[model samples]
Target chain A: TKISQPWKTTITTDESVTPWEDATQYNNFYEFGFGKSDPAKYADRLKTEPWSIEISGEVSKPGTLHLEDLVAPNQLEERIYRFRCVEAWSMVVPWLGFSLADLLKRFEPTADARFVQFETLFDPKQFPAQKSSSFPWPYMEGLRIDEAMNPLAFMAVGMYGKVLPNQNGAPIRLVVPWKYGFKSIKSIVKIRLVKEMPKTTWNMLQASEYGFYANVNPEVDHPRWSQKTERRLPSSLFTPNRIPTLKFNGYEEQVAYLYKDMDLRKFY
Target chain B: MLKSRWVKALLHIALLLPLLEECWQIWLLVNGMPNRLGPDPGKVILEDLATVAIWLLLLGLAITPAKQIFRINDLMRFRRMVGLYAFTYALLHLLSYLAFILGWDFSALWEDIIKRPYIIVGTLSLVILAALAATSYKAAMRFLGKRWKKLHQLVYPAVLLAILHEWWQAKEAFNEPLLHLVIASALLGYRLVLFFNKAFSGIKNQQSLRQTARKNS
Candidate 1:
C-alpha cells in the first residue's frame, strides 16, 4: 500500500473546475460494493497516494510507472463529451484528458502491435467489487491498434476540471466517447500493447454483452435492447422515455473512416 | 352456471380494458401523437411504466405472502390486477422501445435482440412476464394448478432479469439498480430461508408424531 505523497503539478491543466464532489460522493461504485451509496460512502476512506501503472506487453518500455511520473509529462485538456452507457442511459460530462495517441507514441508501439488493452487497478484489498463473481473486477477494456492510436481516444486524469474522485477512477482512465461507457476503463493501472486482439475483461466475462470494438453505433443495436435510443440520465420519473441514439454518438466525422470497409454489424 | 358466466364476463371485460388502455397509450407514442406527459416523452413513459410494473409484480407476489403472514386473504382478489398491470407496463416498455426508440424498424429491433446482452436479458424477462400474465385467470390456473405455481416460478427469474436489465442500462452511476438488487435479494432471500425453516420443522414434527403413534400401536 503506497501512500500518496504530495507532488508538484509538472503538467498543468489547460483549465480548472469546481470539481464534482457529489458525483463521486453519491453513487455506488459497484466495483466496490453492491450498495448504491456504498462505493461513495466507503471510497472516501480509500488510500489514494502513490499509485503506479504496470506498462507491459508489446511495448518497448515495460515497467511500472508511478502515478506522478506517469502524469508528469502530459498536458491536460478538457473535452466535454456525451457518455452513453450500453444500459441505455446517458450523461454529459466534461472530462479533463490528453490524447492516448500521444501516450502510445511515447511507448512506440511496434508495427505488429494490433491492439491496446487497459487494465483497471485491481487490488482485492481496496476494490471490493472484485470479490463479486458477477463480473470480473479491475474492469478491462481494449481498443484496436488504430482505435487506440486515434486522436479521439483519450487517457483521462480528471473530470469536471478537478482531479478525479476515487469513485470515478481517481488516478487515470480511458475515455472513448464514441464507444459505450464500459469501453472506457477506469482507474487504469496497466497498459499493454499486444500483437493479437487483447481479451478485454468485460468481453472475456461475457463476450456477448461487450465486444472488442464496443463503438457507439445506434445503427447496431444491442442484442437484447435497442441501442437506437437512450435515456439521458438525471431524468425525472415523468420524463419521456428515449431519444434516438446517434451514429458514433454524433462523432462520425472523426471516426467513421476507420470502419469504412468493415461491416459494423459483424464487428458489433 | 349463470353466476359463473357473469364472473367470466367480468373477468374478460376487466382484463380487456387495461390491455386496450396500454395499446392506446402505445399507439399515441408510435404515431407521434401528442402526449402531455413529461419532458422526455420516451424516457418519461419508460420510467413511469417501469415503476408501475416493478410495484405491480411486487404486489402480485405480495398476495400469497400477505394472505399467509397477515391473514389478509382478501389480497387474493388483487393478484390478477397486479399481474395484468405488470404485463401491460412490460408491454409498454417493449413497445416504446421498439416504436419510438427503434422507430418501429424491424431490422434495428432484430439487431438489438441479437447484439446487446442487457437487452437480451430484458427481452427474456418480458417474455417470461408475458407468459405469466397470459395464464393469470382462474380457468387457466384451474387447468394448470400445480403447473401454475411452476410457471409463476418464472417470476423469480423475471424479477432478477428486470434488476439486471435496469442495472446494465444505468449510465454513469449505478445507485438505483444496486439498491434495487439489494432489496430484491433480501426479499427473495427471506422467503427462501422461511421455506427451508418451515420444511425442516414440518419433517421433524412428522417424525416425532410417527414415533408416538408407533409406540401407542
Candidate 2:
C-alpha cells in the first residue's frame, strides 16, 4: 500500500487527555464478547504492535505494508462528523486522520480501478470469532473507485487526538461518516483494487438489503426495514423513537456532486 | 413398550406444535419476500425482536437450574421447548440482520462481522445457539456419549455471549442487561453448587465404606 506525503497540522485536540473518546465505548463488534462493555473488556488483548496490511489486486504494486510505514508519512487532522449506523443509531465523533482520496491517489488506481475492495485481518487464532461460520470472518468491505476517492472518506489513523484504541479499529480504518456505520470498515489489512464491484461480505450474504452503495440516506428504505430514523446510542427510551436522517450526513455540499445525475433512489 | 396417555398428548401438542409454530414464524421472517409482512418496520423493532429472542432463550436455558434450585422438578420438561424457542427466535434474528440490517448483502455481512465489534459478538452468540440446537436431538446424545455433556456445556458460554450481544445493542439502559445477567448468574451458580454437593457425598460414602471394612477385619 502506497501512502502519500506529509500534510501536517497543529494538533487541535488533547493527545494526552484521551483525545475524543466515542460518546459510547460499546461497539457493534460483538464477536469478542457481547456486553456494551465487552469490546472494552477484551480489546486490551489485541496486539497492535507489529501490525501489517496485506495489499493486493489490480494495483501495479501489490504487497503488504507495516502499520508504522502507513502512518509514519501521513499527518493527522480532526474532522468531526456524524456516524449513523444501519441499526438506526447515531453518534458524533471527532475523528483524526487525512482524506482517503489523498491516499488512494498515491497508489494510482488504474483505468481498471472500477472498485476498491478492503479485507479485515482474519486470523482465527488471534480473532477466535473468525472460526465460526455464523459469519465469514476477516470480514470484507468495498467502495466503488469514485466512492473510495470521495473527499469526505478518511483513511483514519487516529480518533480524538491519540492513536486509535484497539477496539476502534486500531492502527488504521476507513471512516465514511455520511454512509451507514458498516461502510466504515475497521482494522483493515488488505486493499484490493478491482475492475468489477467486489462482493462486500454483508452484501454477498444478503444482496437485497445491503446494496453495493450503502449510503446512509433516510429516503432509501432497506426492503425489510426503514432508514428514516436513528436511535442515537446513549439516548433514553423516551428520547424519541425516530430522528430524521440527513442526506449525505450533512455533508451534501462537499459530496453531493459525486452523485450528480445519478438516481440516488435507485442507486442507493 | 408402554405409553402414557398424558405423555403422548404432550409429545404432540405441547412439544411438537410449538416447534412447528416457531419454525413457521422464522420462515415468515426469513423466507417470505417483500410486502409479505407489510412495509419494513425499521431497525428498532428488529433490534427489539432480536433481544426478545435472546432473552427468551436465556430463560429457557435457565429452566433446568431454576427447577433444581427452586425444587420445582416439573419445570424441567419446559427446558427443551424453551431452548428451542430461543433458537427459533434466533434464526429469525439472524435472518432479520441479514435481510434488514445487511440488506441480504453477504459482502456487507462479512465486512461487518469482521470489522465491527458488535456484529461480531452478536453473530458469535447466534453460532453458539446454532450448535446447541443442532445437537439437541437424542440421536446426537447417544452418538457422543460422555462428550455430549461437554458439548452441551457450550450453552453456558452461549448464554453469556447472548447477554453480551443484547447488552451492547441495548445502548439505552443497563437495567435490562443487569437483570438478565443476574438471572443467568444464579442459574449457572446452581450448577456449581450441585457439582460440589454430589462430589462431597461420594467422598463421604467412600470413607464410610473404608471404616466398615476395618471394623469387620
Candidate 3:
C-alpha cells in the first residue's frame, strides 16, 4: 500500500501550517451534520473499507473499480495546498494523493468527455445528515475535462502521510487546489465523464450563492458574506490572523489560463 | 421568596450562568486550551451570546403571565433581573460581533447594519433592549411616568424582530430558529387572549353599573 512519493518539494506558504487536529476536527462535511465539529463526532459511523467507485458515462472502460485496484498504479505525493472554505476560513493541508488526471487517463476517457463529475457516498445509514432536507444528500461536484486533467487536481487518499481519517474523507477524495474545499467531494463513490457541465450540489441548491466554477476569486462574493478576506484557522484570541484571499487561491499563475477570456463573475 | 436574601442570590447566579459559562470558555480559548468554541471561536461565541440573549428576553416576557396564572407575586421581583441580564447579553453579542467578526472596523459594521436585513433587525432589537434597560431604574420610571409603560411596550416588537433576525441568519438548519419562533408566537398569543378578555369584562362591568344606577333612580 506504500506508494513511492512522486513529489519532493512540499508546497510552501507564507502562513503557518494549521494544526492537524484543528484541520481534521473543524470541517463542513454536511453528511455528518451541519455543525463544524459534527463530522469529527459522527463520521466514525462511516464504513470506509470495502468501498468501490463506479466509473460511467463517456469513458471507454465504464465499470466498477475497487478502491485498492484504482489507486495501485499511481504513485502518491505529499501536497501542502491551501484549502479555502466557502465560509471564509482557510487551512493548509498536507494531502497525499496522485494527480486526478493519472486516474482519469487510466479509465480511457472518450473525446466526448468534456466534464468529470464526482459523487460522494449516499447511504443514509452511514450519513445521518442525509435524513435532513437541508441539502441534496449525495454531494456532487464537477470539473471541466482540462481542469480535472490539471496537475493540481488531485485524488487524495491520505493526509499527513497517513490514511485519511473518516472525517477527512477516508478511502478516496478529490482535491482541487484552485477551487473552494467543497468542490473536493469526500468519500467519493462515483466519477462520471460527460459532454455537458454537471450540476453541482451547492449550485443546484442555490445558484445565486454557489456557482458551478467556484474559483477562489476575491472580487466575486458569496450572496450572504464577503470573501475578500479569510480567517486562517487556529487564529489567536484577540486578533484573527486574516489575510486577503488570493485569486484562484494563489494558483492564478497555473490555472488562470483555463478561464482566459471567460468572465469569472458570470461563471462564479 | 423575594424576602429571602439566599433565594434572591440563587436566582441571580442562575440568571448569570450562561454569560459566566461563555466567559469561562473564552478564557480557556485565550489560554490555548482545547475549548468548546471550536475553530472560529469568536463567531461561535457571538452566536451563543445572541441566542442566550433572545432566550433571556423571552424568559423575562414570560414572568408576568406565569405570575398571573400561578398566583406567585414573588415572580415579578425576578423579572427586572432577567430583563437586565437579557440586555447585558445583547450588548455582549453586539460587541463580540463588532470586535471579532468585523475586527473593530466601524465602517464595515455600519455598512452591515445598513445593508444586511438581519443585521438591521438585530441592531433594532438591541437598540430597544438598551432603551428598556436604561429606563428600568426607579428614578427614570418616575421621570417618564405614563410614557415609561408605552416605551417599554416596544419590547414585544423587539422580541419579534430578534426572532426574525435569528431566522434570517439561519443558512441551512432552521429547526432551532423555528422553535424559538413558535415559542415567541405562543407567548404573544397568550398576551393577546388576556387583553381581549380584559376588554370584554370591562364592557360587561360598565353595563352592570348602568343597570345598578337605573335601579337606584
Candidate 4:
C-alpha cells in the first residue's frame, strides 16, 4: 500500500489542492452507494489487499496480475490534476500514479485493440449498493485507444502523497484529467482491450446525458443542468467560488489534439 | 382540543424544529465546521429546505380532509400556522439558492431560469405561496371578502407546481420525487372528489325542486 520514493511530475497544476479530508470524504463511488458520503461511510468494508486485476481481450500478456506485481516496476509520480465531476463541481488533487501508457505498453495490446474497457470489483457483500438494480453493477468505463495513450492518462494508486483511499478508488484507478470525473473509472478489477467501442456505465444508464468521450466542455450543456460553470470545492456560502468551466477541464493544450475535427457538440 | 394554549404552543414548537435545524446546519456549513451536510452544503441546504417546504405544503393541504375524515375540527385551528410555515420554508429555499448557490448572482439565476425551466415552475409555486401567506391573516381575509375563497383556491395549483418542480428537476434517481407526486395526487384527488360530490348532489336537488314546483303550479 506504499508508494516508495514517489517523484513529482511536470504535467501538474499549481491550483490549490482540495483538502485530503474533503477529497476522501466526498466521492461518487456508486458501488458502495450514490450518496456523496456513502463511499466514505461504507468503503472500509472493501478488502483491497487480495486484489488481482484480470487483463484480457486483444492483449498478448492477458493474465491475472496481483496488485503488487501490477504496480511494482513503474516509478510512481505525483500529478496535481483538476478533477471535474459531471455534476458541475470540481477539485484539484495531487494524485500519485504512473502513466497508463506505460502500463498499457507492458500489456502489449494488439493491432485490434481499439478501445480499452475497465470494470470495477463486483462483490455485493463488500459493496452493498451493488445489490440495487438501478445500475448495472460492476461500474464500467472505456477510453479510445489514442485517448488511452495520451500523456495525461494516468493509472493512479494514491493521492495527496498517500495510498489511494478505498472511498477514492483504492488499489488502482484510471485518472483521465481531460475528461469528466466519471470517465475516469475507479476500483478497477478488470482490463479488456476491445475492437469496437465499449459500453460505459453512465452512457448505458443515460446516453443523452453522458457520452463516451465525456470531455469537459462548457459549450455542450448537459440535458438536465448547465455545464457552463463549476463550483470549486471548499467554497464558502458568501464566496461561491464559481468559475467558468474550461474545454477539456483546462487540459486543452495537452489533450485537445485527440479530438481534432470531430463535432464535439454531437459527440457530447 | 386545539383551543388549549399549551397544545398550540407545543404544535408551534414542533413545526419550528426543521427551521432551527436548517439554520444550525447552515451555520456549520458557513463556518466550515465538520458536518454531515456533505461537500456541497449549499446544494444540501437548498434541497433540504425545498423538501421541508413541500412536506409542510402537503400537511397544510391535508388539514381540511384530515378534519372531515377524523371528525377533529380542532385541526382547522392549526391550518393557518402550517400554511405560513410552508411559505416560510419555501422562501428560505429560494434564498438558499440565491445566497448559497448563486452567491446573489442574479445573472446566473436568470440564465438558469432561461435554460432550466424547472426553476420557473418552482418560482411560480413560490409566488403563489407568497400571495396565500400574505392574505392568510384575518384582516386580509376579511378585506378580500368573497374574493378570499377564490384567491385561496390557488393553493391547489401552487402545490401541484411545487410537485412538478421537484419532478422536473429530478433527473435520474426519481424515487423521492415519485413519492411526492403520489402523496400530492392522493391529497388533491380527495379534494376533487369532495368538490364533484357537492356539485352533482346540488344538480340532483335542483332538478327535484323544479319537478315539485311544476306539479304545484
lDDT of each: 0.72, 0.68, 0.87, 0.90
Candidate 3 docking class = acceptable
Clashes of 1: 28
**Preferred candidate (DockQ higher): 1 or 2:** 1
Query: Alpha-carbon error at B155 in model 3, in Å?
Result: 1.4
lDDT of 3 by residue, A1-268 (tens): 3434454544656766788888889988889988889999997899988999999999898999899999889776788899998888899988888899999998899999999999999988999999887677789999999999998999998887778888988889999989998899999999999999998998888788788999998888776667788888876656777788999999999899899999998999
Which scores better on TM-score, 3 or 4? 4
User: Could you list the CA RMSD of all candidates, in the order they appear?
Assistant: 10.7, 17.1, 3.1, 2.3
Alpha carbon lDDT at A167, candidate 1: 75
Q: Model 2 residue A256 lDDT?
A: 84
Query: Quick one: best lDDT, which candidate?
Result: 4
Please list the residue runs of candidate 2 whose C-alpha ends up more than 4 Å from where it truly belongs after superposition. Answer: A1-24, A30-36, A240-242, B1-217
RMSD of 4: 2.3
Point out the higher-scoring one by lDDT: 3 or 4.
4
lDDT, candidate 4, B70-165, per-residue tens: 999988999999999999999999998999899999999888988889999999999999999989999998999999999998999999999889
When sorted by lDDT, best at the front, the candidate numbers are 4, 3, 1, 2
Error of 2 at B58 (Å): 9.6
Evaluated on chain A only, model 1 obtains a TM-score of 0.87
State the displacement of the C-alpha of residue A110, model 4, in Å, after optimal TM-score superposition.
1.9
The per-residue C-alpha lDDT of model 1 at residue B195 equals 90
lDDT of 1 by residue, A91-186 (tens): 666777688999888877777788988887767678866766666566777899898888888887777656777777777888898898878887
